[model samples]
Target: MTRPGGTTIKNSRRLKVRVKTGKGRTVSQKTWLERQLNDPYVAEARKLGYRSRAAFKLSEIDDKFRFLKPGGRVVDLGAAPGGWSQVAVQRVKATEGKGKVIAIDMHGMDPIPGVVIFHKDFYDEDAPQLLIEALGGEKADVVMSDMAAHATGHRQTDHLKIMALAEAGFAFATDVLKPGGTFLAKVLRGGTEGEMLKMMKRHFESVRHVKPDASRSDSAELFVLAMGFRPID
Candidate 1:
């Protein structure tokens, strides 16, 4: 549909650029809204029927690495709003009865077909075991973590918090992944090339850091991809 001004209305949803004349519109909030409005992934997400644009980050990363496969068992850490969960379900064919996806997050998530979601903290004493059991006693082939701490606006502190979560996710993956499995987690640039990298190198055949195109260029976030898990003890 084309409007009188010759602009296409492909989606038909009203797109607005509301400017505040006065009050209730802070500079930061306005900037955030503008960014969201202009983001290509956000627009593509709506057109592709995804819950959130973050889905593209996972898709792009998986596309390059080919970590997800049909009939593969996967665990999604920090899954919320079912964005990544949705993609995992379709890619792994969990709807066809050949695979399972166990998603864990502290936040409540709307239901997604072919995904078993656990609304609990992954660090809870029994959460890891519960997720493993929910997979019907089968170890996971791929463990993916998109967990991030609530940013405190302090750069150093925020970095440390995200690293802590990544470490916890790594620990859970190590406990439940089968030999030759894979682990992927979000981390800051400063978080890698340290003790965590050393530990990953010892446990996996290869560890690579990736920044997907969907990720913001200014963001400090990157993903750590660990392939070929080697179970110790």
Candidate 2:
């Protein structure tokens, strides 16, 4: 028998809670439960008052790449639950009156201090311009995208959906990023192929894929980091 908070279970295949007994066991449900209970980053995120463990994912990724900085203006796409926005707000010291963070999501978010949040579909024709205006008409120093489409359990379909989101994110970056600015977006494990990478290569001086430690080991998610924008005329 384990006491509450005594030896927090490490991620394992067998640590799942069965809601209904007998032979109805589900592999995905088991994996998810075990992973959630055992994830150290999740615990740390709670302790540090972050909205989700994903905050630490961004933190770790930015630690390696150093895209976010003091006094830097940033935009967070798909900023629901505000974990990434919380991280950005703290890193840029928006509370200290130095920098700004503009976050958008289709899902509603409880207000995060020092972060400006917009509830709307990012694909709406006027949304990007509205975000720019909300930032007092300033170009962003960094743009981060964690937007992912609802999974349809079809691997190829999910990949295409996520790639489309990334492409839209890149388009926004092209419009708003300063010459030396950075763009980061969540991608699948193997990185985008063919025309996608080609397009990123043309627009940014360097592009790389990173898997932050805070992300679950089994997750296919990774981030695509783009540095030094070269927008087409």
Candidate 3:
């Protein structure tokens, strides 16, 4: 399949995987299992040793935008399971000591080579200061968030929840990002709106919504990429 970055993902057609509704399995559980078993991205992620299939979403985005460059300092908000951090580490050459990747999450994550993990909720009052201190008082070249709220199964509720996280992430980005830095965060299908949209336009040279091939076609998820940060005087 052709992705937005003009990269073609080659996958051989395979027989569909089916799951039986067993004694302990609910219908939704069985459906989710079947989908995971049949997902090419999941299989490929396992083969490549990525922490999760979501890695491809960041990969596809960075491939097109070229923001995660070597020697860049990146702050990843809500980086649990560390998939995006893994990609960022390699892309930024953190392992070679040329860059830095600081990943923050409310939940604990196993360590990834060259990544500094903060097991704390970003909503905590002290979180921003901690992250900035970890950066040695230097501004970040990029701040990204793949954070999403737990789905309540109500569409509008879920959308609002995720948007709240995105907005919070953007606010934090403005504080830590160097001039001309990038901000990337996950959002729902309708994209950013109202004052948030206007703020992004004023602060960024360009802002756009990107849906990567790694995102399920039926999923409401999309990413907002705001590049070239222009902090106000």
RMSD of 3: 2.4
Tens digits of per-residue lDDT for model 3, 1-233 = 65323335545467899999999899999999999999877877787778988999999899789999999999999999999999999999999999999999988799999999999988888887888888877889999999999999998888889999999999999888999999999989654444577789899999988998889989988899999999987
Regions more than 4 Å wrong, model 3? 1-10, 191-195
Residue-level lDDT for 232 in candidate 3: 85
What C-alpha lDDT, on a 0 to 100 scale, does residue 70 get in candidate 1? 93
What are the per-residue Cα lDDT tens digits for candidate 1 across 53-103?
778788878878887899999999999877788888878999999789999
Q: lDDT: which is higher, 2 or 3?
A: 3
**The candidate that achieves the highest lDDT relative to the unseen native structure:** 3
Q: What is the Cα-based lDDT of residue 29 in candidate 3?
A: 95
Q: Supply the TM-score for candidate 3.
A: 0.94
lDDT of each: 0.84, 0.81, 0.89
Model 3's alpha-carbon lDDT is 0.89
Which sequence of candidate numbers ranks them by lDDT, best first? Answer: 3, 1, 2
Deviation in Å, model 1, residue 138 alpha carbon: 0.7
TM-score of each prediction: 0.89, 0.86, 0.94
CA displacement after TM-score superposition, residue 102 of candidate 2 (Å): 0.4
Candidate 2 residue lDDT tens string, 1-233: 11113423233234433343226658777666666666666666676788887887787788778878999999999999899999899889998988899998998799999999899887788887888887789889999998889899887788888988998998888887888899999887444544677889998899988886666777788788899888778
